[model samples]
Target: MQRDYFDRVHFWGRISSVTALAVMLGIPLSISLHFGIWPQAAGVLNGLLKIIPMFWSIAVIEVLTYAPLLGAGGTYLSFVTGNISNLKLPCAINAMQNAKVSPSSEEGEVISTIAVASSSITTTLIIAVGVLAFSPLLPVITAEDSAIAPAFKQVVPALFGALGAGYFSKHFKISLVPIAAGVLILLVFPALPVGTLIPVTVIISLLGAHLSYKHTQKKEKKRQNQA
Candidate 1:
């Protein structure tokens, strides 16, 4: 039964990912056809040359970093729907924590997928409603001097800070390396993109965790010997 479930998940995940890619590509193609104005080969190549390097690297990094925590189904949904970092990941982590399931377990896969799916649906509905009903408030909301501008600016930071605090408290030693490295890197190269920093910190954090675990094991072995 477990094998059958994973088989079906893989089948549908691949299908949906491909379909999403096609729909995304089809949009610009359709627009160009309707206008009878296709971009020149040189122009397209130039644009891709500028974009592909950064985006391609980040795509690979995000997949490697997020896949384990998200599980197969959740990873597929998060990638397809976008906003993995700020929304889907947080939702999935919170759900798994609540359900008391490890990410590698079958229960975690189900919970993570459900969390991501629900977030995607809720996001879509919110966007639709905002577009239809809040169009008039866009100017107010976006104005630099608006009353709520300060609060809006802090939303992403506040969300991440809250999540970071929880995780850091749980894994203080392992978290220190990445936190310090990230701060130092940003201070040294302020222009560096956040996407580029993600994988660097992830690598550093993994190394830190490995070393911490090994040290703990060594101490345990020494204590056993003394006893």
Candidate 2:
């Protein structure tokens, strides 16, 4: 009998997922609080943030664990067989296998994917709700609006900028292609609905990845020929 993949994530993976979720949420929250906007909604925001660890525990245990292990077999087959179409088969098989005992098997792996996606969405919604719910209470907690509210709103971009800076610092010139592509997208984005930005950004990023991967392969071949 096959053991359920959801039950099989190593202890370390749970720890990693917990750490990732904390790091993801904590940085933005910390930045917002430091800017003083948090005090206004401190009670609600703190309560919501505190609950995330528990939520993450459930998501990691019930959802994301299978995608890596069972999906790996499919990925390997796709690579060796040169048939990328078969990639989903393994993921589907794993999902079905796991679903047999899952409480909501009717929802299946799509539900798991949505659960993982919802984690990010839920975090954003929690912050938005906290701000909206506590806006009236701000006067009681603070002297005035000042720059704190704007700074709090800036947390998402600031967090992303810090991440991008870190990546660029490590990768250097390799990051330039994506940076250029992003600039191009931004330039054209004003003419298009905001929804188009995401797909364009994704395509540009993938193109950058492909170029970088090809460059690395070529460099490796050159080094091998020199030796």
Task: Give the top-scoring candidate (TM-score).
Answer: 1
lDDT of 2 at 210: 83
Worst 10-residue lDDT window for candidate 1 reads 162-171
Residue-pair clashes per candidate = 0, 0
Q: What is candidate 1's local distance difference test score?
A: 0.92
User: Alpha carbon lDDT of residue 58, candidate 2?
Assistant: 50
lDDT of 2 by residue, 27-70 (tens): 87999888866555777778879879776665444233333433
Q: Which residue pairs in candidate 2 have backbone atoms (N, alpha carbon, C) closer than 3 angstroms, thus clashing?
A: none
For candidate 1, write residues 82-170 as lDDT tens digits: 99888899999988988989899999999999999999999999989999999999888879999888998897889889878878888
TM-score of every model?
0.92, 0.40
lDDT for position 129 in model 2:
85
Q: Cα lDDT for residue 61, model 2?
A: 42
